[model samples]
Target: MRQIWHVGKTVLGMLLRHPITGTSIIPLLPDGRIVLVRRRDNGLWALPGGMVDWGEDIPTTVLRELKEETGLELVQLGRLVGVYSAAERDPRVHSICVVVEAQVQGKMQVVDTLEIIEVKDFLPSELPLEELSHDHGQQLKDYLNGMTTLA
Candidate 1:
């Protein structure tokens, strides 16, 4: 199964015309927990984010994804943690994620059940890194290490 999946991913990557762009937002709560969503397709926990539509700016992309996946509108789009372009980060396509660490205000709810299976808060220390999708675990690690300052 793993080998088949890898082969499929490789084929998909090769067929793509260009790398896709996306945005990820890590929402930090007052008690120090960050919001995460479990992807319905792969069952992997990930930061809230999705693809950037054509002509959409990075901030707009991040805000839209955050609201779509996590049911939270951006109270403040904190800061860009970094851009991740590692070839291995996404399996379906050559992708880039503009990772943002932010303080968001909203009542937690599962909005897009088709895409997101679960939503919850977790401390960076307690996050199940092994089960995190893409390079999200590493992104969170960078955030925890103070790689980006919150605005």
Candidate 2:
């Protein structure tokens, strides 16, 4: 029992010490619009993404998160927009976000109401630039600049 308790503590400690890995998708529609989800937590718009699950690759994580948050299907995984690892990037926890641009197609719907309020697409010039959640504004800026980054 003591050994089990020690193992559990060690695992928990490791989890807390490491930054969680996640993917943020820049979902681009066929008509050249970008998709964003309205976050239920803060009522702000954000990219469609989530933490990478165990035994999952970045591409899989991107696909799953995109579908779960925006009900969109991946047409093609586009470029690597950037990898954001700033400690204060996410207010909730320390997370390393792998941002990817994905060509997607589907009707927009809120698949996870608990996490999302709504899903909508916007033209590049019509994005809620200043109101995006987390480090998403920077992520989009980087994508729009046509620069692949490693920040």
Candidate 3:
């Protein structure tokens, strides 16, 4: 998990340094699963999100990113989970991430745009180790451990 940690720190740094404008989702499924995506950039699974265009609202941004990245329509959105940053999470630059709770209800599909490599729904325990972002992994672990509820 050394690489994962480094990557997490990198992402954190990018967000801090550049103040990136991005949106992400914690898409909860009907059966209480979460929607996760494996991106082509690093082949790791992360919450669905993307950079926002100028003047876009956070909720709209989250909805757009989810559909563009994972082809899911969200039903509800809740509080901001948290913002993360580090020196090594992203290689390009610091990415300012806005993470929020999203209730998703729709047929799932991989966007043909090719940003995402794959999509999956799994119990927190069943998450593929290869696809997890080291930092977000902790959040998932916390939820799985019953330390936090999807608000």
Query: What TM-score goes with each of the models?
Result: 0.85, 0.90, 0.75
Q: Give residue 15's error in model 1 in angstroms.
A: 6.4
Off-target runs (Cα >4 Å) in candidate 3 are 1-17, 129-131, 142-151
Q: Candidate 1: lDDT over CA atoms?
A: 0.83
Candidate 3, residues 1-151, lDDT tens digits: the string is 7788778867776666555666567788889888898878778898788777888988889888888877888788865676655534445555666667788888788984477888888775577644476456655654455454332
Model 2 lDDT per residue over 112-132, tens place: 989999999999999988899
Ten contiguous residues with the weakest lDDT in model 3: 142-151
lDDT of 1 by residue, 1-151 (tens): 9889889877876788678988888898877789999999899899999999999998888778888888876777777798888767787777887888778878777888889988899977889876789888888888878796321
Query: RMSD for each model, in Å, please?
Result: 3.5, 5.6, 5.7
Superposed Cα deviation of residue 111, candidate 3 (Å) = 1.3
Number of clashing pairs per prediction, in order: 0, 0, 21
